[model samples]
Target: MSATDEQNLIEVSGLVSHYGDRQVLNNISLDVRENEILVIMGASGSGKSTFLRHLLGLKAPSAGTVKLLGRDITTMTRRELFDLRKQIGVAFQGGALFSSLSLIENIELPLHEHTVLDKDTIQIMARMKLEMMNLLDHEHLMPSELSGGMLKRAGLARAVIMDPRLLFFDEPSSGLDPVTSAELDELIKQLRVALNMTIVIITHEMQSALNIADRVTVLHHGDQIFTGAVDELHASSDARILNMIHRRPSRHGVDSDYIDQLTR
Candidate 1:
């Protein structure tokens, strides 16, 4: 591979996915460079979530390849895949912390499961991550005790506790007030610089995408319609892109034949 290719932390080429008879992704391709934040945005049912799943190796693509940290996931053995996951972290939209576990325990779970670290060492490491997220004082609290923004930060703390090389966040700004969402955006950027990690965020919030993304990729019905800098995205005259930016309904009306196929 060339040096530029070597620098890519994540690469997806001609990826396709299907759910039963329905095709969710239509030949997508993208690259995420090291320490860069790439935002994937699309309306609901636009396959952004499906694409994230494929990237995470939660689901295999029907065709093409996904490479992460110079490894082709499609060809990796189960054991190899398991090892690959240790270098990656994911923060779900709802934080996905276990209610029964304290914040510190949640962050330490990965260290305990993935490494042979002792209890004191693990607690220390987890607390360090909590400090990074500014949640050291709340480490003893359950998920229910935190506010929405705190929960998101706590999830992020757990995600980066292992010092992952790549981080994926699903809708980090979802369900947050404007000020809190902006704070989260700043935190994401800070983490990338502090950890030197490649970050991928899947979101529909246009403001968040424009603010945090070094590059933005817009998905329309599973197809990658746009991938470029925020200014280019704003300058584009494409109807789909404009509709997405302006929050207008899709111009492509659904046809009756497609509806019939869905029913059948």
Candidate 2:
């Protein structure tokens, strides 16, 4: 392996997955460098979520391998995988905070579950993360009491509360105004520098991708059509990439036969 490849924090090779007989991911491969923010972009039903699940070891691949933090997850035992997950963190799209829990409690969940730290220590750590996200005051509020942007920030605070080496974010910009989205983008960038983390963000938001990504990977109908620097993505001559970037509708819309089959 080359020096650069050896530096990869996450490496996926020939990844293939299926939902019963229907293939969802076709030979997808990519590498996420340590301390770099890699953005995975695709339209709905493009296997972006499936691919992310594979990275998290939530699903097994039909073929190929996934190596995370220098360990092959495909071969790891359940206990081994669980232990490995302690160094990783995920922020779901919906925030996924418990309705019954306050923001501080929600952020404290990971530290509580994973470590034997005392309550006071956990609270201090959670509050530190909350302060980092600019959510110190709202730590006492419930999930419903926060706005959409605040919810995203709270989710992010929880994700990084453990000071993980790897962090995953799903749709961080979804359901936010342009200014709020931009703020979240800046926060993501700052977190990478401050925490020295390798981040994988799954998003369809063009501006968010361009703003925070050190490298961008685009998926189309389960195939990885493009992966490169943001400028390379913009300067490419590929029609599909251009269409996606430009927000153009597909020339071939929904198939009549598929629609009929679904309806029937």
Best by lDDT: 2
Error of 2 at 24 (Å): 0.5
Residue 78, candidate 1: C-alpha displacement in angstroms: 1.7
List ranges where model 1 is wrong by over 4 Å.
251-264
Can you write out model 1's per-residue Cα lDDT over 1-264, one digit (the tens) per residue?
899988899999999999999999999999999898999999889999999999999999999999999899988888999999999999998899999999899999999898999999999999888988889999899999999999999999989988999999999999999999999999999999899899999999999999999999999889999999999999999988898888887646668788999999
Candidate 2: lDDT of 10? 97
The estimated TM-scores of all candidates read 0.93, 0.93
lDDT (C-alpha) at residue 122 in model 2: 97
Per-residue lDDT tens digits for candidate 2, residues 161-195, read 98999999999998999999999999999999999
State in Å the error of residue 79, model 1: 1.2
**Backbone clashes, each candidate:** 0, 0
Q: List the lowest-lDDT window of 10 residues for candidate 2.
A: 249-258
Write down the TM-score for model 1: 0.93
